[model samples]
Target: MTDLVRARLRTTVLLIVAVLVETTLGSDLRIAGVAPDFMILVVICAGLTGGTLSGAFVGFWAGLLYDMFLTATPVGLSALTYCLIGAAIGALRTSVLQERKSLLPAAALIGTAAGVLLFVGAGDVLGQTQLLGAGRAWLIRVMIVESLWNAVLALPVGYVYAWVARGSAGAERVGSPVRRTSRSAVPTVK
Candidate 1:
């Protein structure tokens, strides 16, 4: 199989696994009434590994799938929020951010916090006022705790995402050295 197809298959499997874990064990893993958002973490990983288009694509699907299991908000809310966040992260990764050992955790920290705000803000704008019914204090708590949780989990998740995305174009740009064919290196005789 080609690398693109293989990478896509791996990513799809990873998303399903993330959803399952999030739905089944998420609550149990909560600290101070906040649970880790596996879906967003995966989106962040996708952005870090793949760049803008990849991030947005993965974010939309991941959010849509996550929406199916949600009852509190409209179907496309998560999709929009995640897609925007993923794309933003990807843009930053390509433009402003430098690759480093700490990149994953740092991105996860900031991305998750932004995601929480975006989700709540979007939801409220869409008439889902209950999102803020808990008030700013609760929202702040969720943002901080969830960001911390994602940061802690980022390394392992990022490694797995890198493995899954191996051989894809964006993965090459982010994680691996590009291989130059010998034919390209040989100078053509005039």
Candidate 2:
């Protein structure tokens, strides 16, 4: 099969696996009371590698799936939050941001934090109001811990994501060494 076709298939399957793990294994493997936010990681990866449409599409569906399984809030809230996060991160891929040192991990860290904040903020606005629930101290603690969790997860998740994309696209299967006619031959731009 073609690389593109393989990528699409892999991406779909990955999303399913992410959701399954999020609902099932996530609870079993919680450090304290927080899960790995696998769906968020997947969405971030999609945005980084697949562009806005892929990110938004995957984010919407993934978040919706999570929302459906969740007992806490309304269904569309997470969906909307992920949609925005995916779009924003995917848009950033077009700039010099990705080339900077530590850009990918930084993006993941920032994106994850933003995503969580947006989720809670939306819940608060929609009258879910978990932001103020359990008092200010608990809320701050949750934020700090979750942020740290996300930061810890960012690098490995991003690596896996890049690997998945490259593998699916067949970009990583073979190295192409350009034949040089001179000492400093630059390949022509497409």
Candidate 3:
């Protein structure tokens, strides 16, 4: 199989595992009444690694799968939220964000915060008043706690995502050989 296909397959497997972990163990790992969202983390990683289109595509499916396990809100809500977050991250990655050792964690911190706000805001706008029933203070608390949680987990998760996305479109391979044109083929501009 082609490398892109293999990469996609690996990513799909990772998504399934992330959802399983989120549904099974994520609830048990809450801090300050906020749980880590592995689904959003995966979508963040996809955006960081694979660019806008890939981020949106993966986000839609990931949110859809996650929606199946959710009982409170409408089915497509998460999908829309995730898709927009992923696309925003991807766009930032390509144009504004610089590559650095701390990129993943930083992105996770900011992205997760934005995601929490967007999810709740959009839900509230769409008549899901229950999302904001706890009031602004609760929302802020959840946003802060969840963003910290994701930032702490970003390194390992980002590493795995980089591995899974290897050879896929827009994935940057570490230590890849630089293409050097032969000097002899070009006329010397003496």
Q: Is candidate 1 or candidate 2 better by TM-score?
A: 1
Give candidate 3's whole-model lDDT: 0.80
- Where is model 2 poorest over a 10-residue stretch in terms of lDDT? 181-190
lDDT of 2 by residue, 1-190 (tens): 8766676677677778888877897677666666667788778767755556667877898898888888878989889989888777766654334344355556667788788778888889999886568776765565666666766776666665555555442222111211112212211111
In model 2, which regions exceed 4 Å deviation? Answer: 167-190
Comparing candidate 2 with candidate 3, which one achieves the higher lDDT?
A: 3
RMSD of each: 6.3, 6.3, 7.2
Error of 2 at 2 (Å): 4.0
TM-score of each model, paired residue for residue: 0.89, 0.77, 0.89
Best of the two (1, 3) by lDDT? 1
lDDT of 2 at 131: 54
User: Of the pair 2 and 3, which is ahead by TM-score?
Assistant: 3
Report lDDT (CA) for all predictions: 0.82, 0.66, 0.80
